[model samples]
Target: MGCATLTPVPEAWRSVPQAARITDLCARVSCASRGATDVKVTDGKLVASGKDLTPQFRAIQSFDVSLERREVAFAAKRSDNFDIGLVSLDGSDIHWVPEDPADETDVQWAPRGNKISFVVHSRTGDLVRTVHIPTSFQLTADFPYTAVRALGWEPAAERYAVVLTSPEASERIERLKYSGEGRESVVAPAVRLDVAIEPLADALLMRPSTLHYGERLPLIVWITETPFEWNDARGALMRNARVACAIVRQPSEAFWTAARAVAWIDLEKVYVVSGAPAPSPAYPGAPLSATSVVADPKIPTGRYRVDDRIVRAPPAIVESVAAGWIAEQLKDRNGPR
Candidate 1:
């Protein structure tokens, strides 16, 4: 027998009304311009831009954007001088925290929204400074260069990675440490470069992550044949070109040996590669290709299939493979329920 038709409820009767509705959160955006070197953002209906500006250089640098305080901050170099400044995003107000006339490199936003940290150079020597904000930001103190280079904040900004560079060149991996202000101590030593530090695509390329999210990651270091004229060494010489990664993180000492590669697709997203490379010829030198390229998410197995003939992996496939490997690591580390 066929079922009987039932009466349907009216649209007005079925619809439910809420006592109150929540509005959307305001978006806080900040950007830096080359011509002005000014950081700007919008606060509510008003637009604000910062001052104490300088000409932008080709090097990749970043600034802090505080939505809570509605301000933009960045480091600037003028007359061979480095300084940090905060200003309204609309160009109405400006505040400057200038550094001593010295070489300042790798200025970055502190994990906290209210402070900035950077490498500073003075007549005495090179140092690192962490500056407080709002109630007049200023340099708090100077830390050793080793700590400065390895300085990285934890996910929550509460802790930092502290690395020490040894005076001896052979002891490259012996220098890195991870700790807070009062508990400074070495966490790992004799770490391999490929395993110790991972490079971020945006940071290594000297470009913003937003613009290069899907682009191929560049090689941080490569062994390429050097021109004979440039090299005084008699035989065919190969030189290592060091490229800095955009972001770096220190994993627990236990997992250090298993780690093989580190990469960043965007500011917040990170991917680490591990496990042994496939046997050579069939898989080549490293199971992974020479260059760390960004991959597409839709690919099979989350890794790139190499075309051995050209000795190059497609950028899109590379990113996908890296992403897949990272996903697998997360699963294994987290464990299944």
Candidate 2:
């Protein structure tokens, strides 16, 4: 019998959420404008009434038109990151939507135009935040998967349909109903969180099997594209000391969610070791560049480099280097061991 090979199809033919979302937005824009005038990006400019609505230097990423044809919501690159920009049809009152400092994309206006929704790309995962235009009140919607390409809001219900990719590169459309909950911070003592996260991916949260009464420990969140057996690393670290380690498999949405959810971890001593380089201006602290990142005034940030040597070496050596780095981070201060 001859062996047969099966080749996978290209991603372009598999998923096109961005194009589909843009098409839907364009249709809405066509219907809302009513042919009185036109609103669209022409010559790389947001043009309407024969004028450019956005700054000449900034690049437009995505945009949507209001139902009344009065305002345009668009995402543009200001400096290193993207911010949602709003401007009137007449090219007046150009401003940005008040939101967190991250790359916001896929701007969409709610059915009533009173609210705007966009995806915030962070080091942890992709978050869909809807902000009230009047009050600037923000509500967050978290998903179990990353790589959200498109998001749509329902008119009558507080629900969002998100198009995302699974770990196996298959496209999925999930409908989530948000009640302004699910993202609240936990304040209790550190213990196993019995969070009933439906469809939890292969993300694992590891800690010392036992902790002394009222004792907190430092946490190392290792984000990697490839998954490795953590038994050796966990055994080495546990034997050295009581440092908690979490492994976030690639394309999983539980990066900071799993780390921050552990209330017992010493927030000040939390370190991030990325198998790949940290993205630019994505995390709370400085970009993961050197051995450690300076704090971001609000949160601590650091990066650990896993060079070629570490990658080729065994898991024990890789994690041993991490342990040394963490100890160096806390050496100056009398912090958690």
lDDT of each: 0.34, 0.53
TM-scores for all candidates: the values are 0.34, 0.46
Instruction: Quote the lDDT for 37 in model 2.
Output: 44
| Tens-digit lDDT string for candidate 1 (1-337) | 1122222322322222211211211111111211233353222122234432333433324455555565666555444454655656544445767656665655555554566666664432245566666554454344322333334444454434433331111111111112224444434333213212322221111222133344433322211121101111101111111122222212233222222343432222222222223223431222233322232243333224333211122332332233332333234345454
Stretches of candidate 1 off by over 4 Å are 1-61, 123-125, 137-141, 144-147, 169-180, 191-337
Give the TM-score (vs. native) of candidate 1.
0.34
* Residue range with the least summed lDDT across 10 consecutive positions in model 2: 185-194
Candidate 2's displacement at residue 27, Å, is: 15
Query: Residue by residue across 30-126, what tens digits does model 2's lDDT show?
Result: 1222223487787557898788887664677888888464788888887778888888887686778875677899887777557888888864457
